[model samples]
Target: MARAVVRAVSASPTAQAGGQVEEDPAHRTAAGLLASHPWHTTPLGVPGGWDPALRATIELIMGSPVAMSLAYGDAYTLIYNDAFATILGGKHPAAFGRPAADVFEEAWATPGVGDVVDRVYRTGEPFREAETAVALVRSPAGEPEQAVFTRGCSVVRDSQGRTIGVLTVATETTEATSRLQSLGELTGALAGAVTLDDVARVALRYGLSAFDVDHMTFGVDDASGWRVVRRVRGELLDEADERLPPLWRRLPLDSPSPLAKAAGSGTAAFTEDGTPLREVAADRHDQRQRAMAAIPLSTHSLRGALTFGRRHAHLWLPAERAQLTAAADLIGQAAERARRFETQHGTAQLLQRSMLPEHLPNLDRFRVAARYDPGIDGSAAGGDFYDAFVLPEGRLAIVLGDVAGHDMHAAALMGQVRAALRALALANPDPVVVLDGLDKLVGMLGTGTRSHELFVTVAYGLLDQRDGGLTIASAGHPAPLIRHASAEGQLATVGYLDVPTGTPLGLGGAHRAMTTALSPGDTILLFSDGVIERRRRELDDGLAALAKSVAEAVSGDPRNLCALATSAVAGATEDDVAVLAVEYASTPSRSATMNVPPEPTMPGRVRQWMKVQLSAWDVPEAVIGAAVLCTSELTTNALLHAGTAARVHIDLTPERLLVSVQDSGTRGTVTRAHTDTLSSRGRGLGLIEELSDAWGTDPTVRGSTVWFEILLSEDRENP
Candidate 1:
């Protein structure tokens, strides 16, 4: 049988009759080890007498460059190339001729390696794993450490197609895999940052965690010099001993420091000694850093540097330096973007403020307050605006409007629209008529500008002090919210005034005005769509929230109401918000009325009647003097211009005293005359204008009324 087996082995293509063929030269060391091994004392006989399959497999293993090994027979005896010997760490020489189970006893117990080999041998199958962790005794002291490896195992078969051994090819991947994962996390953290401070916080946190550094500092180049903006130290440092510097520090730009050099040259610099940085340290005694590296960061808007320190005198590897450089670049780009955004935001705020009304006009019958909040970024001007001004005939005009876009063009268009609306309101007191004129003007404006498709939504209203009635006209605008006390005197009862709205301005349409009677202690709110618009929410749901908030704050002041409405809704939308609130006072105004004949002495009679009323009202002498002069001038003009009997009316409030003179004559214009030294007839209107705080005229159904106001001092006595 031995002779027959030998003849069969000799007849095989891979074997000779007396011994195995010479091994390939590519794996000389492995071939030499197997040739000198004591295989006869173990599972297999001498190498020359081995089975043809085993001999062929050994020859292939000896010729490969990868870390490959073959475990044959039931005992799983190990045979490997010289390349694989390096993977065994300290056990290389002794494990060369031993069984894989004995050489890697601790690793054999792990499922990814030893179990995979056993299964492949038993089932005649193949298995592969990438970045698999195996606990192996790689440390010099025989201690096990978790090492990652990309491993492949296959069942080796004999010429008769019988499974004989398991073949494995492995490449250690512990260092490279860790590096890739750390870089991925760092990139993700930097991508979400939105501001300079956010960038600093995220970069420092991730850098410290990923690099395991003792300390880190970030510096950026500005017009003045390079400045340190952020710093962090290892968690192991003593809290009492680690005294950080102030939040910011200026470094000499032309100095020999690593940060300055790195930023100036746009390259990385390193130093094993941190004595240079320690020289300028706020707490010199805490200079425990030994290894330091300054990496450059550059972006379109900024150039900066990042410094990393280690407590031990360890040299930074090339891979580590490359990773640090990459992380710094991401941080620099993000920070530059944030800086540019902030600059734009500040400019937009300034432009928007300039476009909107700075102070609402103080009126006799209404308390007005307004607020405007831009979008989250605040980097673009929005088209929302509000205005409140006193008009003729004891009426106050309040306007809230929004243009179609958010940009500089929209803001500019808003200013033009607001100015047009004010000019139109002065000519036509009716809200609907004023809106019609505004629509035509806005249409004309759009046709001449690049924003021809832009439109404006407006809620314009007029409040009559005579009867506390409110007349509102909407041009594709949200209805005003009304809050008042209930019949039982409970405050904060709220309701919406829904009226038919016309097409927005710039799209010509006839606007209809709606009238509502307002009682004392009533409040009205007008707002842009942003006030009730929210992300992923129904418009009605947002409106409900707005209504609930308004009802809760109805009893508060108009300023507080505007604040509440804005704060409640501004955070929920990216659009701009504008809110206007008006609260009607409860007390009726005090007044005195008299009729004057169209006589040359009418001015004297009007002054005497005003004096009696002033005395009864306990008006201040200074304000009374001014009021009498204004009344004399206004009544005299009404008589001279209208040629009709003048009806004089005086109304007093805590803030001002108003006088009105009505004549049953055709409406006439009032102009401030540039009176020469010899002129007498033209000086009266100019004198009235000079003596009053504010004055204007309004035409009535049968006549015209000229009105003037004198601001009362706080010391004036009130009835």
Candidate 2:
């Protein structure tokens, strides 16, 4: 009980004119306690001689329902009501008539409380604290516990406005404030998680710190019910113990365990007896976990649960269970989003791979490598592709192109264009002719379709194995970069090809081919615009950076060079990327030219000249046999069809041997007709095709030159 002292004062006749003030029951209760207290004989003197301001303030505090107190006089005597006495705990009656510091010695000694009280008394100004924490002994024999309070202090004044005491009012908010702060920290930590594993790791780390638990396990629902994905032990575990049993690594959702029940009901559950779950948790760990809790986690596409364990038997409070449930919900939502994205990304990759080539063709004269990467947005497939294949006459055709969209439609169109180009290229050896045919094909395919405006940019090249040069043509595509070796053996980009940029396919236009020579040890690089058309970067800057990277990796392997180039720009652009690098291997050059008369003996003369040249070059007998047969077939076709003399040229290199037979008449196009089984005259081109690795025709100043190449056997030693 708390007490207050009442002073008896004799009133003058004028003062007695006003009716006597009514005594409040709360003030009377305190007065009775203070009258019997020992401190009644102290310097404060039973409150009879107290100042008018102190007496008035005490009366106001006793009458109010608010918890308040008043400290008066030089010694600051204590005076408070029943409401405030509850805060005093067991010290209420003993605290009566004593100085404020003596009654609340422990609390007054706290940093902010005492200072605030003194400042309000001295400055005659109000002081307030939104939240103040103090350690105080609520009972005489009890240990001190920390309590948080929102306190306000103001000066008490008499009728003349002279300060005489300090009045204080306070409210305790320890539990509410602490819970809010802990929940805030947990939410902030979970916001940064972007993957399922990230969510598990972050939740485990913060949940353990925020809750009272010895260990925690996080489980997610999968094909095998619920499985623990992460396990974390609290500080109670011994640091030296490395052997711990795998506890609760897997749990069946339909089981009678607390975690399962919680997940099934979508609610929080707890158990004091760990025996029910001990079998599942029986790992190498020796800690006697006697108590546990389960919090259900669920979202639109995800279902999971979290379990917490304690070494001693304990009951969870309602507040603790609520916080755990909220945290579990956050983790479930984040993980669900991550899993959805992963599935979409995997599907897009599968679709993109199906559209691109599995591997570039293996060439003996050139080292070829190519790479394709999808756009930054991983959900949709982009339209970038690269192809390398053997053409007639030992030429290698490298194609890199991009359709004008970033969806499945674009990928489908890319596949159609690629297949059509390959089929057309086998019949015609000229890049210009190939592009012209491709343009018409694309136009026909796009007409009257939703993708009528969809166009494709392409950079196609035919590599001449005999001279180690490239004949390139562009269809509104970025020019190919040619790297030339300097005298010091260092490589640099000579320049982009100067080919005329024709209109993109799907529209009608004339396409021309430009010739660029590549020496041994030189490389030709072709790429989609995604490599040099990044956001916020100028086209020239990107091209310059690409050139620099290529020059630096000049001595690197062709496969590694392609990887480096694609990686540099893969993430910087939103378009799909395709890069192809072709390096010419150095080979000894040899050539023999012979003129064949326009006679019935032309085929025999051509074969004799090929045999002589091949024998002098020390070629293998297998290759000599194939080369002679292919030469005879080509010579007979040229002299019989063109009605002119044939100019025969045989060029041999370390990789392949080229046979060129030119005629005085011009035949720009040669089609491979399907010959019947009994037709002998039409089998000339068929036999040439069957015997040679590749064959093609190129129009020259005099006439047309048709050629074929036979790939030499690897077992034959190079000269």
Best by lDDT: 1
Query: Model 2 shows how many backbone clashes?
Result: 9
Q: How far does residue 192 in candidate 2 sit from its true spot (Å)?
A: 6.4
Candidate 1 per-residue lDDT, tens place, 448-548, comes to: 87566887999999998777798999999998998884442244788999767888997898899888978877889999999898878888987888888
Worst lDDT run of 10 residues, candidate 2, spans 669-678
Query: What's the lDDT for candidate 1?
Result: 0.70
Query: How big is the positional error of residue 706 in model 1, measured in Å on the Cα after superposition?
Result: 44
Model 2 alpha-carbon miss at residue 711, Å: 30
- CA RMSD per model (angstroms): 27.8, 29.4
lDDT of 2 by residue, 545-581 (tens): 7777777652423554565577554235767778888
Deviating ranges (above 4 Å) for candidate 2: 1-217, 224-228, 231-267, 271-277, 281-292, 308-315, 392-394, 450-452, 464-467, 484-495, 567-571, 585-719
lDDT of each: 0.70, 0.66
